[model samples]
Target: MKFVGIFIILILVFSCSSEENSLEQYANHPVKFAKQKIDNPDNDFSIFIPKNWEWKAPYKENGNDILGLFANSKSNKNGFKSIILVKKYKSSQNSKDLKSEFEYLSKQIRNHSQIEEIVDFGSTDIFNQESYFFHTKSKSDTNGDSEILNFLINGNIEGIYYNLTLSTPQTTDFNTDMAVLVQSLKTFEILK
Candidate 1:
């Protein structure tokens, strides 16, 4: 009887955790712009990128913007959440899966903010690559929480990561300042 009680309690705890997670799933993202090129020569794909923002340098190897959206502002200037990253996954990964993985991976960023806002837009194909896109705007501070507006995707190879994070102390019109990174998204086909 004691064992049964413990087991039931454990189940309830796990169930509650799973339910809470599902509720918090991408419910705070804010995507204000999007476009795609499904006519790539090799691999076809679609992506929702930001419109325009401040410009920076390209992503360094093993760094954030692995897809090539030109990234910088790594360590926030004394707790200011500002990070722009882009990269194309090496392996052939489509969009649907990418969207799922992005949520999972965003949690893996070195200084990932605690998601407070999430919004899911409909899914669409980019040329031939299956794409999953969503918007997110965090509402926390650096040490306390963060703020973010993101458009994440998965290119059917490995996995593409495009993210713009706003950490603590963020004061700029982050939305308007992220267009440069957002509009740089380009689609391509995977040659077979």
Candidate 2:
């Protein structure tokens, strides 16, 4: 009947409009970043941090030489803070290549007691260099109501291997956070 066809057309139109609106929301608002240079003399590199995010350079903790730590000024609705941590490691002669090193590291992470589950793992190219990434869900040390999401990306430059970890409270908008994190990571550069 004519009424049935009209109703179908109206439903299709509104559904399409809603889909377009959702896409437009993301397209209209792009995340911004500011370049943050590392102060470490041994391994020099720069990374783009989210605009207005708190930055701490030359961060060292528990014997780990963290070159930079960037944290969101505001906590998520769950009262968990999101942070990006960068660590530099000297490349060893025994390691074959980035892939091998990444595999070895991934194994270590999988065996870690804090890591509850590895959501995903794969290889990707970053700035024309090979990079590996691991998306993991981990147990939160703070409390039981929240879980932690760890997105670990590893890439190497000449003699230095860089590990970038984006840690955030597991939330419904995690995909959006991950997209922003990847965008910021794309701006990383080794200072000459």
Question: Which structure among the candidates has the greatest lDDT?
Answer: 2
**Steric clash pairs (candidate 2):** none
Best by TM-score: 2
- Candidate 2 per-residue lDDT, tens place, 1-192, comes to 999999999999999765411212322347654545433444567776676677766665534343554445357665666677777655444455677767777778889887886766777555446677776767666522223333333444444467777665657765466556666656667564
TM-score of each: 0.37, 0.66
Worst 10 residues of 2 by lDDT: 20-29
Query: What does candidate 1's lDDT look like per residue over 80-186, in tens digits?
Result: 53444444444223434565665555455434545555543334443234444444445553433334434454443454543333222234454343433333333
What lDDT would each prediction earn against the true structure? 0.41, 0.59
